[model samples]
Target: MMRRRTTLLASCTALALALGATACGGGGPVTAGGGDKALSGQTVTVAGVWSGSEQKNFQKVLEAFSEKTGAKTQFVSTGDNVSTVVGSKIEGGNAPDVVMVPQVGVLKQFAEKGWLKPLSKTTRQSVDANYANVWKTYGSVDGTLYGLYFKAAHKSTVWYSPDALAQAGVKPPTTYDQMLKAGHTVSDSGLAAFSVAGQDGWTLTDWFENIYLSQAGPEKYDALAAHRLKWTDVSVVRALTTLGKLFKDGQLIAGGQKEALNTDFPGSVEKVFGPEPEAGMVYEGDFVAGVAKDQFGRTIGQDANFFPFPAVDGGEAPVVSGGDAAVVLKDGKNQKAATRLLEYLATPEAAAVWAEAGGFLSPNKNLDLASYGDDVTRATAKSLVDAGDSVRFDMSDQAPAAFGGTKGAGEWKLLQDFLRDPSDPKATAAGLEAAAAKAYRG
Candidate 1:
């Protein structure tokens, strides 16, 4: 859906300036009024774009914190655009004590700019012990801790209607060759094989990244994102060539790119399961489940199923997921309390609450699939934990914020074009390499 949330610094900076330096209200951290206790009746303002379901989930956790620590919790909900509100607040220097964000890249961006507070050594140890190594890296920048990773959603999977597949006599492809073969089989049967939305470059970009992971491996993908690696490298060329093969071979749905440009996310979702189907498979994150239910009128577990993004020969199999991080503003008080909140949020209990609310995979290693009331949520959560290797957060989130969507979009477009004509793989690879160089320099 291309919904990007905001950063803590941006949310609070604007509010701070609007308050005109009012003695840094929100209790200015817990006072040692009693002389020994570290925390005492502190009022903390927390800003986030959470509302409706997410807000209710957060409220429960805040209420518990307030009761136990005597901290007054006030929420400054920032409607729809989290980044805009956060950016404005950061400019004003009136940020909240804690702000919850969804993307780890934004957390790192703020950290690099000196907007985030360093997490304590104890917090790092706690994180290392409980969360996966992938998340540990996300919270650290230049060897210092700046943020905490929380909920995540795996994207390297294809969602399909099992009923539709059975009806068309198409089996789920276990490998790349199988996927192509299945694509042809489904197409021959008069059903679209794969439905990809290239008009929104983000959608197509994911397909390329996932393919790169399958062809090159995670380490190389990391190097590419860091600009320490060249895009013209054989692996990069091979990945694009593979993508071009998919587009030209009719493996992708007819007019998928043009259709995607005009397709509503929900309506596109309907095409996967609705009676009038344009495609039989969709490659998107777990968030599509909500839209699927709302638009397709088909229950997630009963009508739809998902499989890991297929693997390639000799390729390292790793699952990739993405989620946000919460950063404490440098200007904010309650540093220690804020640290406590971050730590608490990483706990299993907090994860459970988030799962119940947001329907995303929690970073906590102890997330209980049994607690998930819905079968689809449980299955999705199970797939995340069962993944052989954890590759949560895509290349976009892991890449430098400035170079992410801007340059990545161009790569997607070129890949889409190349996907339609596999004859000139070298030229396509060169085009991507040039774009990568420009992004890295910028």
Candidate 2:
């Protein structure tokens, strides 16, 4: 079976299905001439929320594209709140040719405002043939394709320390009941079994989504995304109930709920390899292993390993991982070149460069695993693409802005509260449903 791994920041993909590398030389603008007419004097200004490693990789791709098309590409990296910056640019009529934002909900809004351009026939055919269902499903606003997918980072898989589990004589669980059994085994040894920075509010939603994946399956989730399913549905309630049980079972650290609300992405992994009380398992993506290695000097395969979030007994396995994608603005000045970049990004060379640089899973299925930097990342990428089973995008990321905002955070708080006492699962879920319904109305 293909081994699984998680991507960085569960919210990263939720924030867009979210992209490259190279050196550069001064060049003139190019045209879209294919054969002998090669694109020679075109320039595409890319506005993206990429900096540091993301920028480094992106430059490589831009340089490569420049080399191929003789097009001069300029990049402007935005701060984390790219939405605000992008909004102002759109209003000021200074928007770049291309911008990468997380969450399709924002893309839909842009499409509604006529900020994004419709795809050309070529771009449409390319995306249809190569991109996965997740993006195609979310990339469209109405029936038109407003976004093109490039790279993805997975979120739903659980990260753990296999060596640590073996040392504690605990096996990885295959079902919810089995997970509880393993948790008891590890807790008996006085070590943390599950570690999460629950203070982030989004973290709780990750847990909630996992439960939903196991209980309601992908059909219900798809309906949820389309706003057809009620949050108070019995299946949704069951998922919430399940999450509450896991929280109260003493499987996680004592202050997990509190810690989740306050801690950042790497905190949970640190607990697993930190100073005083090292934990054995932390549910996170492959990037968390990098954090553990950087902060605690732990190697991934040596000190930690990951597994799929187990099958739900007789139910089908839920494909869970989170990643980001690229989108071009329709009415923007550089719409043509932006669309070209989107198509270029789906190539194997670009995909490999992205995977090697940032350890991100590129959405391009044509990428060769042999080109990956390491076996772990290669394996992770393979698992993400090969997932033929049901796969749902991240919950908060898939939901509307209202559901992903304070209201959603409040719902998670309620889940935590209900986990502290499961007697009111029905009431808690109903309340959440009411909140979601109210949010949808606005």
Candidate 3:
């Protein structure tokens, strides 16, 4: 699923001041193509899943591009089903010039259909200079570079209120069992241990992914992602059962199961950081920090902090990451302008534009740590890069969209069902396998 967030104007204004730019606008223009207005008459259209405040921040990046190259840029939100929307546009010959694809599976699908343009040599060079080889590998199809991963997420971090944890007299956990114990302790102090975002099925998939990756290891994770191993495999059952250890406890969840099932992602975060918090912690990506700071006026490192998603059964914690890749369309009218946008996105300057805005992370090794608005975000990005080859992409995003990305269906819906009644891991596994078999066959 595509994560969507709405940031406050105050947050945007603060970021602008920090970067010496206008609110939700770019900094001073830097000339591109050896001229200030080289692409003066051109317009470029870009599409992605971002909307509201997220879209506004991305517009800042585009604004910087416009100032440099003198190209007008438009951003179209692809809504939730990005693949379907972009596919329809392509069929109707109204495809955008550029797309920020969130799913690697979708990127591969577009490449296979010959709808995507191979990135320019200049863009590839920028990627090589700024990113790690693993990022490039994900952007490539059949050994040809096709996308640049501009926005990255560290999905293994768990955000919590330090005061709440301290009230419970517990420290951040280092293992799965310890985390559960901490939850129980926090619950005893009258706050729900976790604000489960059951309404958003993607969050549940992330929970399962972290546990599965750490407990079963990367080989099984890769096999399941490719459907080489069935979802009914024992490894999946073990992971589901492990997750049930936490979800099975009603008191451990904020607002209980019913309310949690109705709560969206942002609501889940609010339960922990709001004026009168209902929960002590939330599990998701590093973006939670952005929501906490932007929406609740919480200080990231002090008021809100995170620990590595604790290791499972004494194993090393696995980093399950996700990113949005910028890909140009072959059918685009302004090919040169689109390629230049891709090149700009690959630069540290572009990454820094969003980094200072909060709730954003980049895989660009060249980006300065100071560019992040807070120490937590900088540490999160550092861990993501420090993990190097050990990091695994989000497993669901690696699967076909029908099975992984769709709402109210496939892995997403099945996980929601499991959240409602976590008693039957075997049954959930069976259902997932059935769905995967169908999606893979298609």
Name the candidate that leads on lDDT. Answer: 3
Which digits, one per residue and each the tens of the lDDT, describe model 1 over residues 1-442? 1111122222223323222222222211211112222346667777776665556767766765554455667778876345567778878877777777655556666676677887655456556555667677777889877777666777877888886678778788778778878877777777778776655555666777888887888788788766688878898878877776676665467455456555544566777877787777888888677657655667877787777778876575557777767677777766666765665565454565556654467665555565565887777777776662456467766654444444235565565566445578788778877776775565
Name the lDDT value of residue 429 in candidate 3. 99
What tens-digit string does per-residue lDDT give for candidate 2 at 101-189?
66666667677777777765555655554556766776787898877667666665677777668877977778777876787787777
Q: What is the TM-score of each candidate against the true structure?
A: 0.79, 0.83, 0.92
lDDT ranking, high to low: 3, 1, 2
Candidate 3, superposed: residue stretches over 4 Å from native:
1-35
Question: Judged by lDDT relative to the true structure, which candidate is superior, 2 or 3?
Answer: 3
* Clash totals, every prediction: 22, 36, 0
Sort all candidates by TM-score, best to worst. Answer: 3, 2, 1
Please list the residue runs of candidate 1 whose C-alpha ends up more than 4 Å from where it truly belongs after superposition. Answer: 1-85, 249-251, 333-337, 388-392, 406-428
Query: Which residue runs of candidate 2 sit more than 4 Å off their true CA positions?
Result: 1-43, 50-52, 70-82, 274-277, 293-297, 405-423
Better of 1 and 2 by TM-score: 2
